[model samples]
Target: MKEYLDLCQRIINEGKWIKNKRTGVRCLTIINAEFEYNVRDNQFPIITTRKGFYKSAIAELLGYLRGYDNAAQFREIGCNTWNDNANKNQDWLNNPYRKDKDDMGRIYGIQGRSWQRPNGSKFDQLKKIINNLKRGIDDRAEIITFFNPGEIEMGCLRPCMHTHTFSLLGETLYLTSYQRSCDVPLGLNFNQIHCFVLLMLMARFTNYIPGKAYHKIVNAHIYENQLPLLCNIQLKRKPFQSPSLIINPKIKKLEDIETWVSVDDFIIQGYRHHGAIKYPFTI
Candidate 1:
């Protein structure tokens, strides 16, 4: 993925130093960067510059599709990404809505699948999109959104990759994902895999050929603590060719995805990459 590597380089060369409020860390930041992955061509955008944790990424997506709100649920699916963000936030720890230490509140998948309503009801956004696709009903708004402004306080962390809009052209399906903020060194690696897998799974269940997955990023930044690993070590290496994602064709329905899909159901082919880099992450 030359685009990803180039973006990293561009951030170092052109980004300005800025202080981030959440992590209290300085960042070399930029704005409004965009990229696309050609799913039809099997161009999986896993980073070859550093070892990518693709399994954890897909598992995290599955947890969201299942509408889970607990960090324990994500860990059961082999993703520890939410462990820190969920339990470590003192505000969330003190909030009454937090059911237990593992509770993630109303972030990501919880919001996408079971967005809470004021009357204590839940709306299933992913189901609606699937039903629309099944009926061939394109009203120009086949969208799945996880940005719940009203419940921002209820959630442990606000979603970065917020909205995803799916469009159809004949038998081909295209996806456009929007992210409001990104930590390029750590977050972008997983985010890319999530987008690619989302498009593939959506296309598979909806009976459409996967076309392209476009990612739009706003306020992309590399944390100052991660600059040494990213710019000095990671960026200096050349990236290998993009990997291809393999999904089980037997997954004929959306229910299959929600009910019984495992991490093994999704596979990466020919992924040759550099060793993993432990980029610093702060909640």
Candidate 2:
């Protein structure tokens, strides 16, 4: 989408270079920035500048909604994105809180679907949102937050796309996704897809039409190793028209998503883009 291309170009032109301590890599970083996607026009925000893996993106999102806390579960769902962080991260492997093999601890879907309370009770954030939406309630608190302060030490990595707030206006649904940190080259590609598709799915089960998706980024950066690729290769390409997402009409309820949805159930039409650019990913 143009918005993605613009954000990338803005980072290239305006970002400041800094040495990131976590990955020991240089980053072209920028401060607060935002973008929006119009779901009402059926705009699927997969990056057209380079080959975007819609299936992996969708799978990751689905795995989160299913409350998966294991990397094996994500792999079963056709997403190996968590493999590196879950199994290969030496820091997490050595941490005392790290559980058995392939455990991601309490992060993302684990926190979103079953957040733990001080009383040792579990709170289902996703279920609550769906239930409230079903009752046509727009109480300005339809939020699903994956950032758990208490469990940060237990997880392999903190959530970048941490919170999502859904708003209802009449019969239309809109979403605003918040991110604390963003790896512009690698993470943002999948993130845009996640935000737009998330709104689409939420609207589907809640009896509302998808309206728009907004992404708010607090710290957006392109890794120094990835700058050459984004500037010389990926960013040089032209973006095609935004594609349309096709979800299974058979998905009639929220529970159906947990047991019935797969990558095959989602399709994207008219997606034409440049070949894949293997930008360097840091854990």
Candidate 3:
């Protein structure tokens, strides 16, 4: 992870800074990593020195995954990342195009229940992939997509913009995600780490031994305002530790079974370190 931080710093010193929708101005670039074979029990991709914007990130992710477009629920839970858009004068409250009329009408429910590809398919891709895994179908063809090109045009934040492919090889599954841009300090770094954790949980829910998730960040750029923070992150050193697993003995719905695979189980090695260092950012 130090290597990643160093590279990000070097890019900041030489890269261009530009304004982004999510975090003002940022330093952006393209990053590529090639792997010879599958790597197992690898270091989790999360940064340990600082809290990687977990609370808001998790709320936003759950809202998208569950298909809840409203920020009311998240705001009540101390999450306000989506409030900016949800509070706008776009009539999101009564938009007729909203597929789900109620809170249950979320992307997860729609995708898990009413999703169909353009070719007249009647199955939810995500659920189908999970069922296939339950039946022990280990192949590269088990990929599920969350990006809907049609929806992207209709004012929806592009779904699963980062994650592109998921493949199961034996008990371990490998994931490939593409990000056209990243806020290395504020958003992208944390998003990748959380998404990796989510994927691991999904793998365990389907009774597969959770292994390493290969995160491919294309066009990986850091925000200029966050360069100072990245430098401080690089200076920090900590040993990684294997994550511990937590399982719920009682299960009700399939969703509950899925939730039983706790995110806490997917631990980043050696993140426990000294107090937070001050890394101020100047745009």
Best by lDDT: 2
lDDT of each: 0.89, 0.91, 0.50
Superior candidate under TM-score, 2 versus 3 = 2
| TM-score attained by model 1 | 0.97
Candidates ranked, most accurate by lDDT first: 2, 1, 3
| Model 1, residue 246: C-alpha shift (Å) | 1.2
- Please write out the lDDT profile of model 2 over residues 85-172, one tens digit for every residue: 9988888999998888899999999999999999999999999999999899989999999999878998999999999999999999
* Per-model TM against the reference: 0.97, 0.98, 0.68
Instruction: State candidate 2's TM-score.
Output: 0.98
Model 1 agreement with the true structure over 102-200: per-residue lDDT tens digits: 888888888888877889998999999989997888779999898988888888888899999999999999999999999998989789988889998
lDDT of 2 at 58: 96
Q: What is candidate 3's local distance difference test score?
A: 0.50
Local lDDT at 234 for model 2: 82
Cα lDDT of model 3 by residue, 205-265, tens digit:
5767655555555455665555555565544555244233233334222475234322332
lDDT of 1 at 230: 80
Ranking by TM-score: 2, 1, 3
RMSD of 3: 5.3
Q: Of 2 and 3, which scores higher on lDDT?
A: 2
Q: What's the residue-level lDDT of 210 in candidate 1?
A: 93
List the candidate 1 regions with Cα displacement exceeding 4 Å. none
Hey, what RMSD does candidate 1 come out at? 1.2
